[model samples]
Target: MKFLDHPSRNLFFTGKGGVGKTSVACATAVKLADSGKKVLLVSTDPASNLDEVFDVSLENHPTPISAIPTLSAMNLDPEKSAAEYRERMVGPYRGLLPDAAIKSMEEQFSGSCTLEIAAFDEFSRLLGDPAVTAEFDHVIFDTAPTGHTLRLLTLPSAWDGFMSQNTTGTSCLGPLAGLQEQQKLYQQSVRALCDAATTTLVLVARTESSALREAARTSEELAELGVGNQHLVINGVFQAVDTTDPYAVALQQRGAAAIDEIPAGLNAFPQTTVPLCPGVILGIDSLRRLGTLDSAVATDVADESVSGDDELAPLSGLIDDLVAPGHGVILAMGKGGVGKTTVAAAVAVAIAQRGYDVHLSTTDPAAHLEAAMNDERLPNLSITRIDPAAETARYSEEVLSSAGANLDEQGKALLQEDLRSPCTEEIAVFRAFADAVAAGTNKFVVLDTAPTGHTVLLLVSALAYHREVTRQSSEMPEAVENLLPRLRDPDFTRVLIVTLAEATPVHEAAALQRDLRRAEIEPYAWVVNQVLSSLPLTDPLMKQRQKHEQQYLREVSQQQASRVAIIPWQLQPPTGIQGLSRLTHCDLSTSPS
Candidate 1:
């Protein structure tokens, strides 16, 4: 509630996924609108669920919420934005340029870099141009998970610096054509973000160690970026009403322990705690009840038991299927905060335990593979992360030494300046991903991919690069050249879509599936992580939450996935070999203690 008090013109709600950023942002926007202030709520997340939360369809442009007359919402869809951006750049040259030239220009615009810059272009307009949002008194941004959001927030300065230093006037962003014209707008956006009076960054987090640690890191990083105006919203803080229920008591204790050992960096921010709601936050009425103590307890509801016919198989079955191939790429991918890293680690551990060579790697910027491994080493298993900074440096050196070897000092200087562009990271990371996939030829490569949006973009880039390789026999790495075909080959790669039994995660996973199928890649199976339906519970709040999870479980098993595996909620955080093994071998048909 304190985060809602005396808010700035711009409010950004961001944190680890599943931390209720969308719920809190929606509630705040509604409250502000109810106070008679015209507000615009925008979701910059590519896998946004504002439509589900608001129970209405949305578009790239603002759509007025039927429930709240003064509140309008929109999803800045990257694909659509990129299409518009491409048109703006290529439209004028339709007949002016040759057909082949036009096709080539369109191909250049199809990469992930274009998608990113296009979305940022839309974001910059909303934040930088006053006249664009003159009708609204406030603008609220419900951003993607921490890692993706940080990259987005840092782009203005990155692009500004890149453009200023580009003497050659050529780089990845050159395809946009009008990027230089938007330099002033990007500068204005950066100024608005850093101006304490104009923007307030709300760091949302769950009362869990991992989420809090991520929030603390984000706080420090944003501060270093000059976005010092910060507020903390600790969501889903729970207290057990039934002392006799061991599961409920343990849950409450875990939350309390996390709060007691709260990160020191978060102590400096203005703090607000939102109690855990008994059910999922959906619709305007439920949104209104958020942040209130009364909503923490469930109303009278039937306690229906989970049916036997709806039961899902254990994760071990999926691992059995995965390991049968001996060697291939296995990707654990889904929306953020759905235990992708944990699932990937568990799969790798299980396979390695079976005496197979396995390589566990992550493309997620915030992934903690070492912590997940818990310092326990397995002779057959290896772990690595595709660190963006290190990859960028290595990639830059390769490009400079190879391409710049024949150039003069001025040409080399220009090439180095081109490498400084933020888009270079995308190229470096893509190459790293390809190399990781290439390893699957000899060993099991389990990749914990980035969140939905970023993952989709990476795949899209693979498609773009694949096309480029076919068009001309360029110097693309063998791994990069073969990436898409390997991903599409069922015998070579298997993807497991991971999700919690919740609305947003399920819907987002479904969206991810659609994207993958479009890319000619079929998911091997779906893994439902952290299911509470099988847990024995006495607390009314816990039971209500349990009842609510059944619908999503059924949805996953009956509709979303042809094959499914379920992992029950752990009494303790699942980390290390023992905890992770429990996930792989959990018997969900029996009640979890």
Candidate 2:
């Protein structure tokens, strides 16, 4: 955290999910504020842990943290932010247009893009522009994961150019006056981000190969976006103080070796390393220790995990219910970095082990399916990744041939330009997902879905396409028409919301369930990955971590879902067939609560 306590007006901590972004952000903010600087910490992550970290209630505004004198914080919920932005953008048309028309217009902005734009709208005021710029000496942002943060960093220019192109008309929504002003703010935000002196983009990630690669990609993307002041903070580096424990030794070696392999793209950026503590980091005391190595590793951390052997239902239990139906779609869906691919692989492998034919596929662009399932796969199982590039190319050709076969050159050029929008990729990938779902009718299809934002957008697109067909009262394409019904059918599709045993993960998973329920899709079960409670701990720190998981484990059992499966934090990384088989045989003798 010493690398972070510098003279920057804004510092953004972003990385892959479950990589400790919130922990690092909170710890850094605490360090800076303790140095007598006025620090305003803002969390733009849809799943944020500020309240859990501070043990205090927070709103959308900067509320002074009573635990710290100079620290203030807020969580910018995307949905809430978008609703407000939508109101301001469409409020004027409310009375002018019919109620139903206004409602329809509002629905257009209710997709994931609106969430990004609205979050950016609020983000611009604090980081990009002059509003309340002087109120705090520093504004520290706890941002989302790599793909999401990268998408947002590029949004300023993307939206500005997009709005500029539509100046003449608002595409039947309304006047572009409000959006035009937003465009100017977006430009200003870009300028603020490009300036190196006042702002810094801190890439926070674990010492794993996947996390490092994602950070490097984020660094390259941010650099391409004109954000030159970048720093790579490899969080959760471990030391083998207790060399006798193979787990500790492996952890330390992995961290050290990972640092040596830093991607060339990010090698020029300054780097910070924080040693791992086995215990769960919570509240002020833990966060203070987290910011500095001296305070953190001065003494051997002791784990005071709840002195109880408690657990949830085993992963093997789901095998019975899942294998009952000879064939069905089992979808592992949740926030990014929640181990969806691994869980999907385990489920697919388990079903196949039971002599059922299972086809495992992943729609997530960042999915590591090959890593999860190695070359030595079961005879009854097969695996695939829904390649976005391949799908997009296929979709483009189909759209061009069918929709533009008779169009003139100018019209074809316009259509081609329209196909380049980000929305096109969503539709293309969604078509692939629909095809995958259709495959389940004949054989079991185990699908690992994209992150929540993208998955929700696909559902929204399906609904919109369905409505368009209904309005026209015309026949529909076979795949497009059956997409909704297939997703809505409980017997045909089993959706498992995979999550970590933590505040943000549980909250986000719950929110995901709410979103799915809105579309008439009920999750078949909840899979809690990386539970520390079930493992035997030699380190005192891990014991404390096991203690912390109790509350979340309880939350999941009593409040989150009716059927919950727990996978303990494994000593060895879950990869290949052997590692995945370990996932299905986990013990669940102890009660979760």
Report the C-alpha lDDT of model 2 over 243-335, residue by residue, as the tens digit: 665555656776778788878887888878887755567788888888466533534435544533254677887989987778879889887
TM-score of each predicted structure versus truth: 0.91, 0.88
Worst 10 residues of 1 by lDDT: 465-474
Report residue 108 deviation for candidate 1 (angstroms). Answer: 2.1
Candidate 2 residue pairs that clash? 279-541, 302-540, 303-540, 303-541, 305-543, 311-590
Candidate 1 C-alpha error for residue 264, in Å: 3.5
Model 1 CA lDDT for position 443: 92
Give the deviation of candidate 1 from the true structure as CA RMSD. 3.3
Worst lDDT 10-window in candidate 2 = 166-175
- Model 1 residue 439 CA deviation (Å) reads 2.0
Provide the clash count, candidate 1.
0
Q: lDDT tens string, model 1, 1-593?
A: 99677989999888877789999999999999999999999997766889988999988788999888999999988788889988888889999999987876776677656676787788889999999999999999997223333354354433545434443233455442466667678678878888999999999999877789888988887787688899999999998888888778889999999899989999999999999998988899889889998879788767667552255888888887788878999999886678888899999999999999999999767667877888787998998889999998998888777777877776676567657665567677877888999999999999997334444444566545554322221267888768879988988999999998887788888988988887778899999988877777888888888888888888888898999988888887778889888887777654544
- Model 1 lDDT on a 0 to 1 scale: 0.80
